[model samples]
Each structure stands twice: as C-alpha cells, then as structure tokens.
Target: MLNKTIAIIGAGNMGTSLIRGILNAQLTSAKKIYASGTRMEKLEKLKTEFGVHITTNNKDAAKRVDIVVLCVKAAVIRKVLEEMHDVLHKDQFIISIAAGVTTESMEKIVGKNIPIVRSMPNIASTVGLGSTAISFGKYVHEKQHDIAIKIFEAVGDVVVVGEQHLDAVTGLSGSGPAYIYMVIEALIDGGVKMGLPRDISTKLAIQTVLGSAKLVKESNVHPAILRDQVTTPGGTTINAIHELESHGLRSMLIDAVATATIRSRELSELINK
Candidate 1:
C-alpha cells in the first residue's frame, strides 16, 4: 500500500483494472485514488463502484495526486501529458503503461526533470496474474522506482529492466498471453478431435496449462529437465514431444518473439516521432 495519492489519467480497460487491483489488494484506500476520463457516465460508474474520486479534467487529477499513472493509448498519451504538464510537479512521480510510449518521449512532453517510469503489463492484469516489466528514466529516484513496483505488484508480478530492453519485454510478456491463448485453443481442439466433448476439452486444456505453469514456478528446475521427467522410452509423452519438435514449434516460438520485438521497436519509433 502506498501512502501517496495516485491519479490515473485514463479510465480505459488497463486503468480500470489497476483501480480494481489496487483496491482488491488493499494497497491503497479508494479515497486516495483519483481517476480521470472523457466519458461522464464511465467516470460516474467508477466513482460509484470504487468509491474513488473521478473527474473529466486530466490536469485537475494530476494536480491533486502524488503519483500520476498515464494509462491512455499511445496515440493520446502526448496530448494527455501536454494537458497535465503545467500541474505536474518535480516531486510527483509519473508511471506510464502506454505501449511504445517511452519515458524519453514523455519527458519531452512533461519536462526533463520529472521522474518517469515506463512499464509493460499484459492483459492478464485484469485477472491478477499479469507479468509487468518496468524501466526507469533519468530523473527517477530509488524511492519512486519502489513505488512504481508496488503499484504494479498489487496486480501481479513485476520485473525491473533497462529502458533499452523494454521492447524485448514488450515482445515476450506483453504479447505472450495471446500466444498462450492460441496454444490453449489448439490443445482444446486436439482433445476434441480425440473424441472428448468440447466443454471437457476446454477445461482440460486450460487446467493443463495452468497447472504446468504453476509447476514450473514452484519446481525451480529447467523446463527441459521437467519435460524429460515426463518422457519415457516408447511412451505417449515422448511421442507427443517428438511431434511438436518435428513441427518446428521451438524455432517458430523464437521467431515469433523476435518478430514481435522488431515490431515493438518500430511502434516506439513511430510514437517518438
């Protein structure tokens, strides 16, 4: 829980999810959090549901908080920053979750002296199982960095990385959930093809992925070693593994991440331009 007030400048999905996560984690009282957005009905709904202060003016929200969270889209982040620039103080911390919007670009909009932390959090944040990667700007101090970590930690896991590596983080964790979803869908289809009912296959596939992930986290062993443990001479698991290998699954996944990283860099360049 942070003692300082937080202002979320956008009431979009990620912003709303953070509000819910912070409240659910008891990291901060609703009274200390303020949300701003364009839609009156949405702001009113958030105020009613979360018991937090809500406003349509971004500058007003920024002026009243100790930390400002930029949750707007990459296309609008510059506009929001310009709107709040006059109200933002050097002492206040800024955390941005807009994909491809770098801290350097935000510094240009706000000020060179303002502390900024840029982060990438996946859609799983809504489910409290997100993986977030954070990077600090030149003006950010140790305490402000810790606060940024606490804010995201309320929703899920947090990892610190260099700003230069954020594009790679964006490629891996930020886009990884969609890849996992595709795999899960394929697994469910495979089960169904083997005569299992659709609903049963869905449950089995989801649970298998979830349980396997949990195992990897808890075992603290190499995944390949774990896979070897499940494989036996002339066995079903080995045959399945062989099939995946024959299909070039490993190389495909590697290429997917690499391609996503390249695209992330291109998007960042576009935003910075």
Candidate 2:
C-alpha cells in the first residue's frame, strides 16, 4: 500500500474515476484521499460514496497532501496552479491530467522547485481500461515517478515517455477512444445494413472490437499478419478489406492521429503563451 496522502483537485468524471480505482486497488485508504471541487453536490456525493475528505478550498487540499492531482480542464489549470502555489512545497509531487498542459508550463506557474508530472489518460479510464502516458519534469525523483505510475496503473496501463513526446501520446491514446467509438458505430451500421437488428448489431460490433483487441494483445502478432490470416483467396473478409482499402480507411486513421497531434501542439503553445 502507498503510505501517502493524495488529493484530487477537481472532482469531475476523471477525478472520480481515479478515486474509485485507487480505493479499489488498495493503493491508499480512502481516508488518505481528499477531493476538492466547486460543486457542493458533487463533493458531498464523493464523500458519501468513497468516504474521502471533501472540500471546496483548493489550497487546503494542496497543503495537506503528499501528492496532488490536478484534474481541472486545460483552460483553468493555470488559475488552479496559482491558487495552490503558496501551499505546494518542494517535497510534494504534482500530477496534471489536463490535456495539452505541459510540465514546463505548470512549473512556470508553480515554480521550478516543485516536481511535476504530466499525463494523458483517455476516456477509457472511466471503465478502468485507460491507456495513460506519463512524462516527468526535470525535478522529479525516481520514487516520485514510480508513485505517479502506480496511481495511474490502478485505472489502466501506463507508459513512460519523454516530455517532448507527450503531444504525440495525446494525439494517439488520449484522443483514441472517440476514434474507436466511431469505428464501432460504423461497424454496427454496416451490420444493420445487412439486415441484422440494431441491438444485435451493436452488441456484435462491440464484442468483435473487444475480442479482436484482446486477440492482438494476447497473441503478440502484428495486426497486419492477423488480418492476412483472416483473409483467404476470394473470401468475404478479403472483399471487405478491399472495400476498406479502396475507401482509404488506413490512411484516414493515420491522418486523424496526425491532425490531433498538431492540434495538441497548438493547444500547448497557446497555454504556454
């Protein structure tokens, strides 16, 4: 068990999900976790459901915790950092989950002395299956880095990357869930077009996607190899693959990730400015 107090500074969907994961994993006791937010109803709900301490004062939460997770939106991260600056100390670690908020930018607001970690966790985290990318600031120690990893691992898989590569991570895993959801929807629509009921199509599409991902992960085979294995000469699968290739499905997905990466970089620049 982690013997430290952690405070989540924004009790939104992501923050609440983390809290549930942390407690369920027994990384730390619920009493050691504090949640702060502006909405009284949300704060009280968290308190009642999780038995965590709740407060509206951000500084109070920051002052008492060994680790602070800033889950506020990117637009409000600077303001929250400024509010907690005086209470945040060198010994404490800060982790930010705000998309496009870099560790460098947070350091400027909180001062360079504080250790900071910036992470990108996709919406899948709500279901304890997130893919999170972590990047450490210059001041973070090895132990602090491990702590950040453990916290995120409770909710999903975690990867460590250089700060410079976090934008790419944001483009891929950070924004990947929506892309996958679209694919699932399209597959369901295709199933319906073939005369399947809507509900059955939805169920089949969801399970097929889930099982295919599991197969790729467990079999440790390249997805292309797996695709070839499924496709026989003049088979239905090959025909479907041909249609997808003709429609530029692969190219479109690649372009989508690239565009998202550029947008992430643009947001970072704007935040830093």
Candidate 3:
C-alpha cells in the first residue's frame, strides 16, 4: 500500500466504483480517502455509505492529498482544473477516467509539471470486472504510474497503452459494453420468441456471454480455432453460422466497432477545440 491520501473530484457512478475498489483493495484507509462533488445528496450518500471525507469545494479536495482522481465529466474537466489550479501542487499526481480527454490537454489545463495519468475505464468497474487502458503524461513518474496501475487493477485488468491508442480503447472497451449489451438483449429476445420463459431466457443469455468470454481467456486458442472445433461437417452450429453470415452479422458487428472508433477520434478533435 502506498499510504498516500487520495481525493476523488466527482462522486458519480465511476467515482463511486473507484471508491468501492480502493476500499476493497484496502489500498488506503478510509481517513485517507476524500470525495467532492456539486451534488450534496450524492456526496452525503457516499460519505454515509463508505465513511470517507466528503466536500463540495474542489480545491478543498485537492489540498493535502498526494493523489487526485478526476472523476468529473469530459466537458467540465477544464473548468474543474481551473477551479483547483491555485491549490494544486506540482508534487501531487492526478488520474483521470474521462473518455477522450488527453493527458496533454489535461496538462494544458492543470500544469505541465504536474504528473498526470489518463485512463479509460468502463462502467463494469462497479463490479470489479472492468478493463482499463492507461497512458502517461510528460511529467509522470514511474512510481506514480505503478500506483495508478494498482488503483485501476484493483477493479479489473489494466493495460499500459500508448497515448495514441487511448481513443481506440475508448472505442472498443469504453463503448464496447453497450454493444455486448445489445447482443445480449437480442439473444434474450430470440430465446423468448422460441417459447422460453423470460427469466430463464435472460439467465441463459447472461451465462452464455460470460462462459464464452471465460473460454476465450482460458483456452489460449484463436477464436477461429475454437470455432472450427465446434463446426462438425454437417452440424447445427454450422447451420446457425450460415444464417448469421447470410444476414451479414459479422460485417455489421465490425462496422459497429469501426464507427465507434471513428466517433471517439472525432470527440478528441472536439475536446481539443
């Protein structure tokens, strides 16, 4: 444990997720964790639920902390940084979870000398199953980078990526959850249409997605290899595969990811302006 005081600048869903993760990892004691936000009730809820320090002033949150997590939305990061800039020290580190917000942009708002770590983490972090991609700023230290990785890894898998790849991570994992969610909804609908009970269909669809993901991780084989293994010369799986292919399912899914990637890159340009 680093034993450093950490402050979270927003108490929203992602902020709460990190708080839960930090508490679960026991990375820092409750007294060392501080949270601030504009919503009084939300901060109260977090204070009561987790027993951490809570406030509404961003600078108050920034003062006396070794590291700060910028959980605010992408649009308002600059405003918040401006609010806290006077109180921010060069020695302190910052970790940001806002999508499409680059480290260089943050440094422009905060200070070029401050250590900043930019990350993209999905909503799954609430359940400790998220995937996070991180990139370093110009002034970040290796020790701070390790600490940021530990903070993210407490919730799920962590990837150290080049700054240029962050937007792709935002496209793939950041918006990817909604894509899988749509697939699950369609699966459940198909099961229900086939006369299965709604509850059972939902459960089956969820488990199928989970199990397939586990297989991809544990089998250590290419997905095509596994696909060939399941395709008997004249099998039911092949028939379904043929139907899906005929309907252009694979191409549509590929296009969806590509579209999301393009949008993520576009957002970067917008944020830069």
Worst lDDT 10-window in candidate 2 = 103-112
Candidate 2 lDDT at 211 equals: 99
Count clashing pairs, candidate 1.
1
Task: Report the Cα lDDT for candidate 3.
Answer: 0.91
Alpha-carbon lDDT, every model = 0.93, 0.93, 0.91
Q: Compute the lDDT for candidate 2.
A: 0.93
List, residue by residue over 60-177, the lDDT tens digit for candidate 1: 9999999999999999998999888888989898999999988888988887499999999999999999999999999999998888898899889999999999899988999999
Candidate 3, residues 103-191, lDDT tens digits: the string is 88899888648999999999899999999999999999989989999999989999999999987788789888999999999999999
On TM-score, the stronger of 2 and 3 is: 2
Q: TM-score of model 3 relative to the true fold?
A: 0.97
Question: Residue 195 error for model 3, in Å?
Answer: 0.7
Give all TM-scores, in the order shown. Answer: 0.98, 0.98, 0.97
- Which stretches in model 2 have alpha-carbon errors above 4 Å? none
